[model samples]
Target: MPRHYVMCPPRHFAVDYAINPWMDPTVPVDPERAMRQWTELRDTYRRLGHQVEEVEPQPGLPDMVFAANSGTVVEGRVLGAKFATRERAAEAEHFRRWFLEHGFQDVTMPQETNEAEGDFAWTGRLLLAGTGFRTDPRAHAEAQEILGVPVISLRLVDPRYYHLDTALFVLSEADDEQPAQIAYYPDAFSPGSQRVLRRLFPDAVLADAADAECFGLNAVSDGRHVILPVEATALAEKVAARGYEPVFVDISELRKAGGGPKCCTMEIRK
Candidate 1:
């Protein structure tokens, strides 16, 4: 069974409501709002037939996002993350307890780079690491060393899109015979990144900015299930048109703090 893992709140990281310069002050940071959105997101996954494992946050690790930054597996492992932000440097320390409590062994940290696992993706074969922002350039080599996976690291050139998952996602076909689809933002892919991807996927689908902002190509999964922001109607339409059911829920509260649905949720077991 597929497992959707999430970290409960109060354990979440939020720039001090007073110091958050990203959003307009007029925008409220009501705890109720965040809870409502997070609850809806959790329920959506549960309703989709996925086993939901809402992990409790560890003490001193105030960031719920720390769960996503670390890599996890349903029956095997739950590796902790090495965060780039000093404020979040202690992010992975709690994993030792969580892993022990959950009975997962092999939960280890990657090499010495200040990088987050959210900065990478496991494509069943190779691991793609995103450079810049939360992950440093040298960290890619470390991922290869620690994860023991063939690693291909690409640099993200835009600040607007902090992670590679923000602009690139993979879609697998329902029919076992159909080839998997890779959707990506052409504008967001720097020349070097583009070259790297081209070498990896010779026929990847290059999506436009409209789709990127719409969240249309930002997420990739089965046609029956897609993960995206509730407000991304254009993206929803495309998914629906492709004969998939889209579960929409408000995560506007998290977006104010620099994350969306994808950033908040990570798949643990497939």
Candidate 2:
């Protein structure tokens, strides 16, 4: 398993701006509680024997807490995020510099708008890219060329599942004995994309409506172990029965800004 470095923002973490549908400037976020919840998440990763490194957060970048959007890294090389929206454009530079300074090779900035791991994840051999949300389809083409991996584009349909990470869970990237396993919500995807998913992953775990609401697909999996939101009790039980050891982590505060475990943790492939 790859170890990840998560960025813990300073006390400045709050809903200063409404970038995503889940964000509402009127709602108040308790920074202290959010920080505590985030810290505990980091500690949970450490307890699982994964290395956790922190990036010093800037005061104004409240969204920096969702570190996985930083960029997509493959074998130490990176493709810096080019945000589709103006609100997050400033973050592209910050993420690029962090990768360069943290022993990762100088990353290539994509011409098309893409939100790094926020729209891209690995299925071991192929890169499963998401579109019709934060990422553009052109970005998918750019990613395939930049990363030299086959890119499978999945179109998202629902605004509630804004990011692919919110609608699909990559359970097991292809291994020797098994092909890649995924869990996803069909309703969140376009009919064609849902059909594509079924054709590709016949045994995919179809998430229930209740589980999707709790951000069940946004959970993080480290092969045998899965980190699920505390609200996803039913999904947790199902995952356990599937032979994965379910580790529960409460990230209610982070979800207010629209993120879960995978959003905070970006795997560094070495």
Candidate 3:
């Protein structure tokens, strides 16, 4: 199992601002329901024998609960995030401070519009970063130099799959011995980027329109087990056929703010 850290904010995790297409401030989310759903996801990780850590949420930062965006952790060094929009700018400092106070001393903040793990994903071999949304492509070069690994930049054409985690799922963590696996939605990428994905990950599980629309690609995996949205039937069936146990969870409440399992769970790889 891959160890991950998650956050559970005390305040209502609602879509109070329109950052992505998934957010609709007009519709209010239930605090009790969101907390219950977040707990279920966290509990699922523990039940599967994986270590789950929590980052205490600061009041008024509703989007802080999506821990994956806080930053990308690789080789025990953290390249902290610098969110693209002002709405999430305050999150960078909070996440950096938490990591530092918890013994992560190598945290460095890049002066670029990067939302970290939300737009940058580790695929065992290298890092795949999503651009044209929250992250800037210029930061990709800096990330490659800092990560000491290849960083492939993929452009997202669709606004719904604004983050890389939403369009792609990296099945195995960097520590796993087995070859890495991936799944993605072709429509989420630009024509050139889509071709790159086809040539690179030809065997990746392809999500249908319905499943992609429901955020099926936002699932998280620990090589053998995958935790995904309960509504992603088509993708779940395909994942099961591929020998992965897909644990379906109801995160509809969090979906209101445009996130799912992978968004909340940030795997630490060293």
Candidate 4:
């Protein structure tokens, strides 16, 4: 099925400060390369019949390129983001304003510190929320109430996979024809959360440390084609075995700031 997505061009993308484990100020980032890779990803989505929308990049918000953190939109009702870090706090209002200006009437900016889709993954049936790093656990309940969906809280144990998008992604949403499927790195979660995941998605694709480190789990799926980082070869093979067409795109420049395909793409389900 075709999906709706929002992406931001990496016009001002840079690793000016270290936020995540993947970011290093000393490491050079090629903004030109990042733009090329981002454009390719956007074009790929367009070629696959997906609707792609763009948010104008702000001058000072370099991390705005990772638009997935903007918010979670479902059935035209948007739960706006509240960034855990002061650096990204301004981005929330920009995204909120975009939604309102773009015909989204039911937009709710949450009071709790939540990085929106950075820690929330909707599976059609429910929301898989992550905490213990960026987002606060309290935001899970707030999202559940605002979005009118069940929110399952998962705690992250590793710093590298701080956001849920870094460690897991929904491969296919639950529908009348099929149950939701996912791909995730088990080691990123706590033992209890890992157990919960195993119970819920027994058939999920599990990524090893190697692929997870490559930010392979930071993928975007349109219920068929899975777009991921080209460096995650092993995970790509596994996804392919499960009947998904793995589309590779190199976002190595963006990866310097800890983002990949899913990080740049925000699915807007309406």
Q: TM per model?
A: 0.81, 0.96, 0.96, 0.99
Highest TM-score against the true fold, candidate = 4
Q: Lowest summed-lDDT stretch of 10 residues in model 4? A: 80-89
Model 2 scores a TM of 0.96
Off by over 4 Å in 4: none
What digit string (tens of lDDT, one per residue) describes model 2 on residues 1-270? 756665655356788787778888888888888888888888888898888887777777788878788788876678888887776688778877777787776479998889988889888888889998789899999998888889999999899888899988888889788899888889999999988899999987788899899888898888888888988878888778788888888888888888888888777776
**Candidate 1 structure, TM-score to reference:** 0.81
- Residue pairs with backbone atoms closer than 3 Å in model 3 (clashes): none
Residue 38 CA displacement from its true place in model 3, Å: 0.1
lDDT of 3 at 94: 86
Residues 227-266, candidate 1: write the lDDT tens digits: 7776666666765665656667666666666556666666
Which structure among the candidates has the greatest lDDT? 4
> How do these models rank on lDDT, best leading?
4, 3, 2, 1
Q: Count the backbone clashes (under 3 Å) in each candidate.
A: 1, 0, 0, 0
User: What is candidate 4's CA lDDT for residue 117?
Assistant: 86
TM-score for candidate 3, please give it: 0.96
* Worst window of 10 by summed lDDT in candidate 1: 15-24
For model 2 the local lDDT of residue 22 reads: 86
Candidate 3 local lDDT, 1-270, one digit each (tens): 457665655354767798899899889788789888889998998999888878878777889889889888888888888888788788889888888888887788997778888988888887899998889999898888877889889999888889988988987645556556788988999999989888877778888889888889999888889899999999999989999999999989999989898888877775
Off by over 4 Å in 1: 10-13, 17-27, 58-62, 72-77, 114-117, 173-178, 202-207, 210-223, 240-243
lDDT of 4 by residue, 1-270 (tens): 789999999899998988889989898888999999999999999999999999999998999999999899988789999998888889988898899899999999998999888899999898999999999999999999999999999999999999999999999999999899999999999999999999999999999999999899999999899999988999999989999999999888899999999999998988
Which ten residues in a row are the worst by lDDT in model 3?
A: 1-10
